[model samples]
Target: MKAKFLLPILIAALALGAVQAWAQAAVGAPAPSFTLTDTKGAAHALADFAGKPVVLEWTNPECPFVKKHYGAKNMQALQAKYVAQGAVWLSVCSSAPGKQGHYPADEWNRILAEQGSAATALLLDPDGQVGLAYGAKTTPHLFVIDAAGTLVYDGAIDDNPSTDSADIPGARAYVAEALDAVLAGAPVPVAQTKPYGCSVKY
Candidate 1:
């Protein structure tokens, strides 16, 4: 009888944990606040970007899905376009220490330069705390925060989930749409979608 009772209790606890995890950075909710160091050693906080649109990009330099965008210059173009329009684009690396994408600041700086990244900052989260808080599940996952700090969008970069750069031309660019809507003070047509890519190396 004790074993049966304990099993149910354990199962309920697990279910509750799952729900809590899923709730982080939920769409329409206030994006979770965090401060992280950039490749240049400058720290950035969500609050600092208040009154401006913010884009949080979960990234792994070694991920093929990420490579698909970078290699094709699609991601850089998006960064340049939005950054030019006054949006703050933050590319975050959540890969843990010793992981495939984890790199020291100097190396990260080199990599970003080599890739021609145009992000406002490349924040590092090697311990994965920020990633967990945002429930980031994939290297290429993306989230958009409106000026009001609400999480307006979360999911894959585009409608196409494949690793083919050719697919990008035909796929709907979800992040761009979200940024446009936010900048225009309009509602996001699609707020959320299933994210695809290599699992975040936590």
Candidate 2:
């Protein structure tokens, strides 16, 4: 009887730990502010981008899901288009040190250069603090903040979350649609959707 009672207690404790491990911010709330070092060692504060639109993308270089967007130049095209429209796109990697996608400043620079990415900064979140605070779920998880620092949109990059490049053309492109709405001073039709991709290796 003692063993049976102990089992239920242990299971409850484990469940609590799981919930704590999956910390994330809520939608329709002010985005959590953070200061992280960019690839060049420059400090970037989330609040600094106040009064301007900002895009926060959680990324993992080795994730095949991320490769799907970069390999097809879909992510870069979005960055280029939005940056031109006065948006600051910050790609953040929260992979821990020695992890599959973790990289130091120099390696990050080379990777970005080779990929021809257009993000304003490649923010490093080696400790996973920022990722957890934002509740980033997967590589390519996207968040859009308005000029007022309110989280306007958060979810998958597009409707299709598969690894096949062929799906790109048919995908609904959620991020693109949200951005277009924001640029036009309209509310995002889909504020949040179930994000699907490789789990962020934190």
Candidate 3:
């Protein structure tokens, strides 16, 4: 009888823990803080970009959804446009070792260079701690933090959820909109949406 009661109690506790973990980075809340190493072997803390709008892009090069954006130079263009305006664009990879998107620092540098990435930094999160803290669920999941360090947006890169670059031109770009709102000191039109992409390989 005691064992039967304990089973349900344990399950409830586990479910509650998961909910709490995800709630840590909910939109409109303070963004979760993290320190991660970039491809250049330098550490970057979320606090380092205080007072500046920050863009967190959870990416995996092997994911077709990511390829759709990069192949069309859409992601890079967004990075350039915002970074030039004082926003920090960080492309984060949370794939674990031996996973599809996992790469050594040097390799990552090469990949970014070859792809013409304009992100301020390519942060590596092999342990997935940062990803988990931010509730990153997909390869191209995106989060936008305002100058005040409040998580203003969390969702997909755009409204379309396809692997075709051609659809990009017509889809509503959510990340860009969020950045614009944050930079202009306005509320994001859409604070959250269902992100679509490959499951984060944690």
Tens-digit lDDT track for model 3 on 1-202?
A: 2222533554686777843333358888899998999999999999999999999999999899999999999999999999999999999998989888999999999999988999999999988778877879997999999999999999999999999999999999999999998888888999999999999997
What shift in Å separates residue 160 of candidate 3 from its native position after superposition? 0.3
- lDDT of candidate 1 at residue 56, scale 0 to 100: 96
For each candidate in turn, the TM-score is 0.92, 0.89, 0.92
Tell me the TM-score of model 3.
Answer: 0.92
User: Which lDDT value does model 1 have at 9?
Assistant: 54
Candidate 2 has what TM-score?
0.89
Cα lDDT tens digits, model 2, 53-139, are 899999987899999999999999999999999999999998878787898799999999988999999999887778877778899
Note the Cα lDDT for every prediction shown: 0.91, 0.86, 0.91
Off by over 4 Å in 1: 1-18
Clashing pairs in 2: 24-135
Where is the poorest 10-residue window by lDDT in model 3? 1-10
Q: Between candidates 1 and 2, which one is better according to lDDT?
A: 1
Where does model 3 exceed 4 Å of error? 1-12, 15-23
